[model samples]
Target: MQNEAQYKELKEWRSQHIQAYLTDNKKLNQFHDELMRKVFNKAFQTIKKQSGEPPCAFLWFVVGSAGRREQGVASDQDHGLVYETKSKKYETYFKSLGEELSFGLNEVGYPYCEGNVMSSNKVWRKSLEEWEEQLLEWMDSQSWESMRYLQIFYDARSIVGEEKYITTLKNKVHDFKKGHPTLLRRFLDNMMHVKKAVGPFGQIFVEDNGAHKDSIHIKNAAFMPYVNSVRLLSIKEGIHATSTLGRLSELCLLPGYKELKPYYENFERLLSYRVSLFKASTTYDEVHYLNIKKLSKDEKKEVKHILKNGRKLHEYVQKIIKKGC
Candidate 1:
């Protein structure tokens, strides 16, 4: 009974409803998550159909930024697999399934990590016992690569399978940090070298030449440094906060960190500004000059103040690292 216009309107309404449903529902965040989940479920179903062991035999974790729930719109996959000690026989099959899941997600939109940090990577897909040993080894040796590995592992959050695996991983990380406080200091030092936009003369830092010559490496310069600092602080204080904001909140309770409260507040303001700018740009390109022309005078002033505070926080952390704390 509907005319062509009515039919078109109804179709648009239905699409909007589906999009809203997906956004509101936790299960469907990224196209990759949905695709990977389906692939894993199908792999498990295939095993079940063949009267083989289920894939749920291991715990699956989405690590790094994704694990910390600070993923950008273009986040790549960073995941790990931890199977029970007794399920070692199915390691190859589980790893193969992980690779398949990675491939499927890549096809759906999420790109494969250039660092080879995906679940499909043999380094990440391991049994619980192996993971424990690897973690201990990394903690014992204070190499840059080892520290990076621990940083990723410490930020891990279980996405599927048993919860106890994540609990065990947390315990392991806590123990490692408690035993080797120096590693945390080392991590902080590495993070400080990753600079933000503002330069020494109070000028906005930018590339000198190329297509992205004047653009800011927002992830490397600003966000990653903040994320790493929060992570280092969290590990030192035995705080299990996964997100940067959550870590900042936890830091407020720690002694001698009461001054950090204002910094955290300013950090949120700056983050919001950056996110707004990113949305408006409609591209994942690096931000060059912040368009103060678009903002009111008051808004521009506030942004400048917020950035100044962020720099202060960075310098404070730098001192803490130098002091071996």
Candidate 2:
């Protein structure tokens, strides 16, 4: 209903507001969660009004890496939806509502997920019962594909949804793990593939080819392995802590993982180091490494030691998986 002039003015005003908010690192960092929650709530309310439905009638989740609360600045949208049991006549209407929400998100600068893992995708938009069956099927098989699917699902935490639905999913994961030890093994084996980031001579390996050439894949090399390892351990221990750092803390108190406390400390240090380096880089697509020549001998030695300990931790995780931990 807005004329062109008013629409352009509003868009410019929003752009300026976002720029000002983001430019102040301390304020933006402190307000990140609050801002995202407000954005999602606004989107939900707008969609509900358009669909003429009660807000509590549907569940929403921010899925994938964002759902895991491990997003980088370049992350895209990955979301899911579950609706209450409704008459067949309302199915199309709910589906349209999902599409509207997805489009609205894109307007707000969250790019659509390249893999179509959005709420607009029927595969991800489902009834609560359908979501349960999908999870059960993935847990039962533990094939390469199944493990891949579960890795994404394992990261899921509800952003906006029926609280019971989130709890139900967590309970299902615990129940499934209780009887499916081999599935755990498969997941661990898949996680071990993350060792590709280490070089043969104990150096941190950066990609040598392709568009990402000469840069370390920080997400894959450092963060994903750490996150995946924590996920595997948490699932085995029946702990539902969602964040990688949180999972490590919870595992420290558990009976069998007492020896892993030092490893967790090392992991935390490496994570902080990587995040700081990434934030300092001029480009988000490239990893930043301190020039070896710029560092004192002692600093160089410390860097090497950190990398060695990280590699060792990865190896230790492999051993634990071999022993069916």
Candidate 3:
């Protein structure tokens, strides 16, 4: 009954304000944070009714876009749990809490992660000790999937519980990368293939067929290159910023990374274009596809510029990392 009531209130609120929030990425993300935090608290209350109390301290941190505080209206779940210790009792406690949190978030309109990156998955629900070991294992593995997991984990931000837990673990990743310079190459390889968004003729690429036919994949084509390149640099410098813009801001301060400053405006423009162009939608996947058909001539020209720059940014970062190596 409590869950149902809260879900209805949240859904109603979202329906009312989503259009306004769509125009402002920062405010939209803050709204997402508020909604998720409320769900977290409600999940806690629900869990307490079943179990007495949490056996120990635990943190619920978001990853992916939510972790970076950059969510479109149709965002899905990407979160994990970090408990204080490695005990079966504590594990059981958090496991239930994790399930409840996922269920609650889904009820309020956030879809479940397709990759099962949510806390309900045991792999993402871990003790502090386990997380450290897991991070080490991921760094050491060097497999494509492991590297992808490491990248996702790097974006984690604690919305509830001790923020230091994530910081401590992230610092460990930084220390590992510093000790093993070759690891940077692996990071580079993991994201080196920037999807081509513009043709040799300078025309913007769009989907060839299906429902989103003729629409550009803004997230992959425009967003990923910038995101992946900046992330690699951040990893190299041990900068802990999760968002691309935030990472660029920190990178701008360093002497070697000064080249990244100009691209900051490019990224800001990209973010604004995304929010202003895409309206609130029902599906998480649809937000990534921007229909060029609806865009004005000036808007299309701006998108082309952004896409071309994104490709250049990918190449520039690649050169920088390779030169250092």
| Model 3 alpha-carbon drift over 4 Å, by segment | 1-6
Off by over 4 Å in 1: 1-51, 86-88, 280-307, 321-325
Tell me the deviation in Å of residue 149 in model 3.
0.3
List clash counts for every candidate, in order: 0, 0, 0
Model 3 TM-score on a 0 to 1 scale = 0.96
lDDT of 2 by residue, 109-202 (tens): 5568887888788877777777888888888874787777777766666766575676687689888777866767888777666556546785
Would you list the clashing residue pairs of candidate 2?
none
Error of 3 at 261 (Å): 2.1
Error of 2 at 3 (Å): 13
| lDDT: worst 10-residue window of model 2 | 1-10
Q: Candidate 3's error at 155, in angstroms? A: 0.7
**TM-score, prediction 2:** 0.79
